[model samples]
Target: MGLKKYTNINNIQGKKGSQFSSQLRGINLERVLIVAIDAAKFYQKALLCNYYGDVLERPFFFGVNQDGLNLLCSKIEEARMEIQAERIFIGVESTAHYYEDIVYELGKRGYGVTIINPATTYEERASALNWSKTDDLDLYAIAHALIQNKGMENKLPEGAYRKLMKLTRARRSEVQKRALVRIQIRTLMDHIWRDYQGFVEIENNKPKKKLIFSDFWGKSSLFFMEHFPHPSSLIDLGEERVWEISKENKLRIKETHIQTLLYVARKSIIKSTEVVSAELLLLRLAIKDLKRLDENVGLLEKEIEKELLQTDGRLLLTVPGIGVVTAAEFYSELGDISHFDNAGQLIKKAGTNPIIIQSGGTQGFYGRISKQGNKHLRFMVYTVGKSLAQHNKDLRPYYERLKERGKHARKAFIALGNKFIKIAFSMLKNRKPYESKQPDYRIFTEVKKKLLYTKMNTYLNIALAA
Candidate 1:
């Protein structure tokens, strides 16, 4: 017989496409041993399998420490020798941070490691197996998933990008904390001054509503709260004394505001009692926490800005309405824009990709976004798009065009978000600044002319009828 050429089992197309077939692309399935680990905090369950997803060794238990890692490596070596395998692939679920150490150790020991999403393994278990869950079954599922290529290759940011991610996450945490503290402050104000919310001024024939204590936990507001602590105290102090206090504290307040504050203080239904003192104490403490959180957030922003300046993130700022924080967020989440082949992938990662619903022979209808990836990135992109739509030279017109085409305001913003991603992808990939060349304006001019003509014709007809 003539010599036959070797082919990967995954390359063969069967009557029904196998789920694992998609995963096996770009991977040589022949003469390869796949080890899948069901990782836990202290221990892990592992299964050794061949490229065909056939289990080679029964499930084994190993600790998460060095001893367990060594034993696991030894087992893999033995299996490789027995099967005469040229390659070994280790697949583990990216559950929390439990898999980090093992992944590091395995990579150091010269093994290819892939991180599988826990959701993927769960789906695999539900679809392929009829039996209840067990360590062995889970391990087998993970291995089979790898053979089918159901996981993404593990890639972590390093150097400046890593620093940027850390700083941005910290900033986001502090910002959220500040928001919570502001809410707590408002809740306390409700109890202390129930009628404070009704205080407003009529400006330009419209109600200009003011926040409680002038501004929420603002410097002057906090100082005033610290000194008076209650509306009754402000009432007792009177306008003159309160004005002197404001001067001493370097607070800028108009004479009318002082009079209004006294008026509200005297008319307030909530009186300060000994029991109310406790609420005041809590409110002051919450305000103090808010100040601390604000300081921390500011510091984190400075660090993030410094790190962003070192990267090509500055190019993102060339786009109108994209500031340092937004650029840093983009750079941190994306790491390198070159990893994505196109803007569509970037949009998908941001979870801004629209969903389509279809059944039977009915045409599909577009639904909301899938919201499958990084939520923070999605929010940042949406905010950036909103800002661009209002301010950016090119994007503003595009946004208006979408609205003119009968897209809802929110839907138009979503479209702008998608457009922003494409523009950002190109800008980052080319390492160039955004050029502010206006798009074709003739269409808008023609629309405007048509609308004006229609309006003038209506007015002329009305006049002739009269």
Candidate 2:
């Protein structure tokens, strides 16, 4: 309703001029804070500040730098003390790891904080019909989004979902760093060795830890490297030692394999023969580090699994294709499921929501996924759907159903993935575990959700007495 509808003024005491407050339920956001991050020294501010009849104060400016995090932490501390802040909302455009500490500082201090995606800000800016862009514009957009979107349904998220967000972001960072090191190892092995790929199959799945750590990379294949142990001494050692190591390693070699492994450890044209020794040392260390990261990633998966078991994941695993890991990812990121209103919302967020391509008058043909949701979750669903199509009897019929209707293989999988959405909705909404057709298994209950959320300690005695 527009603010204009509530015209007349009155107080319970029948005051002369006081207006009756007709504002709807929940806290009202009268004042807001926006923190924008940028690498440049100057940025244009473009905040058109009214939202839902609330006006934002002119934004105060601040700069972020290498050590700006310390200042941000102190600034938020000051804001908490400066105002009563009945409904203080803090918004920032999450850039790099800048938002990491900023969001952490503000959220850690107990303010209502939202680190908005750039898209959300752009959508809101479009609604305002403003085309200009600048740092100032962004700060205002952040404030506008906060006041307008706050107090809407589904605003509060479960605590666990936030934890999962942190974990995924941290994991991505580690994966990126590991790729850099692996590339260096690849370059070394390519230049310093000739038979490296043939022997180790590093080009295959990866420099697998099971293979690398077992004396396979150094001991089993060392003689096969382009610059073998000794170029001048291959004559003294003869072919016997090379043949013995090859057979013992079971490398599936013919007689030519030994010749290649023992080939002049130094070809006159070997480009970097001078650096071969040093390069080998670096490559070995890289393999060792890669092994450690592989183990760490596995440990993280197990931890996520343990926590998901406590939450509602049965709804996810009940589907034919989803396994423990996929189900854990679904529940962990999607939170309590009640946050979504229906199957459509779930599908849209899962990026399984189908999009229609229509022109001004003509109806267009089929289109692909909107692809506008949690990509990790969507990927998990797709993989599960693929597995189900291969091994699941129930899924086979659905796959055929789509194919008969002229859907492509990929389209068929998407159709099943869409159906998976409904199963998730039913499971999460009903607070039930997922079991297949038999329907006899009970997965788990949200223990806190039951018993009116009263503490199970001595507090229970007080409740009974009352």
Candidate 3:
């Protein structure tokens, strides 16, 4: 069999009536006014042009504050009166957060605003054979994009969705900060107790790898780190004193682990006692910061849970592996589910959909994902995939099948992620919870309990104390 060749691929087009096309269909081009804006930190550049690419007004700068906004409104009204324009279309480049204020303000005034992607404007400029860039050039690019009906209606979400977006993004930042603190703590431990995290031990005249404690942040490990970072201190305290302190703090410490800590302390390398003492202070401070950050994260999680429950996102909890955090993050990134027509659109928005590449008389082939959509959404979907593969019995089999077919673990997870998107999309759109094909009593009972009695506050309280 011969390979299939990709031909006649140049005619790919976007769906009709998805942008401003429907409104412009029967309208006269001459009377339509196109207002293009290039936003900046403190000021913005704008120009007025008619629908037929004729500049009606030269590019002008306006401040981005209240007085400036009034000037902008007056300018648009003046231009409308001069041209006798019946329809007006305003386009602004989505430059960081600079365009947000204008979009919101204009939207509130009942002016139709189209948020243009910076990439679209750049391409428009390049097409005109003008490589040099400036605020003036950007205005022309934005105008051209709007004339061709390119841009999006970026209606900022309100109420609970807005709150979810903020909280979820904040939670991600806190998580990253916590991870950095963990790294700093490990670095300090390396200098103080060289073999604190893990070290090789000899057993039966053979090299064996051993960890003093299973988790570095476990209660007993944290107790030693807080009170006795230095080996000399651990040795000075003696096993009896260590046991007494552990009991006082209600910390469980294995006798074998304590003996191993003392052994490592005796033989471990060290610097001057003064140097150790200074590092200890920094280490304790870092630990304190870590604890505070953890509490903040727990509090944020509680808020996210409360917000998620208010929206349909809580239905995601019906899936065995999906949790409140993952659901909230996904929903926040996704915004309103009503905007998506299907699961495929959601996947495309996440940039997880595979790319199609075909050119030069070669057969069409699937390439890597575009990775051009919301990166946080992509991350959350992958997280859901990981959770489902580990805990969701129904989805685990599919994940295993992918691996059996020689897919890498990461690739398998992404495949599962796409499938999960379909599941989630259907669940959200239909306002239904997840249901397994085959009846399983245990999963049913667990899911029912989760849906009916989600005691999120209990976990938050424990986390706050920790």
lDDT of 3 by residue, 63-103 (tens): 87788888888889998998888889899987877888898
TM-score, per-candidate, Cα-based: 0.77, 0.57, 0.84
Candidate 1 contains a number of clashing pairs equal to 2
Write model 2 residue lDDT over 232-300, tens digit each, in one string. Answer: 444445678756656787755566645654553433235444667687677667767866776676666
1 versus 2: better lDDT goes to: 1
Worst 10 residues of 3 by lDDT: 7-16
RMSD per prediction, one decimal? 11.9, 11.3, 6.4
Clashes of 3: 0
Residue 217 C-alpha lDDT in model 1: 53
Model 2 residue 133 CA deviation in Å: 6.7
Off by over 4 Å in 1: 1-30, 39-45, 57-64, 129-141, 197-214, 351-379, 390-393, 397-415, 438-466
Identify the superior model by TM-score, candidate 2 or candidate 3.
3
Number of clashes in every candidate structure? 2, 6, 0
Flag the better candidate by TM-score, 1 or 2. Answer: 1
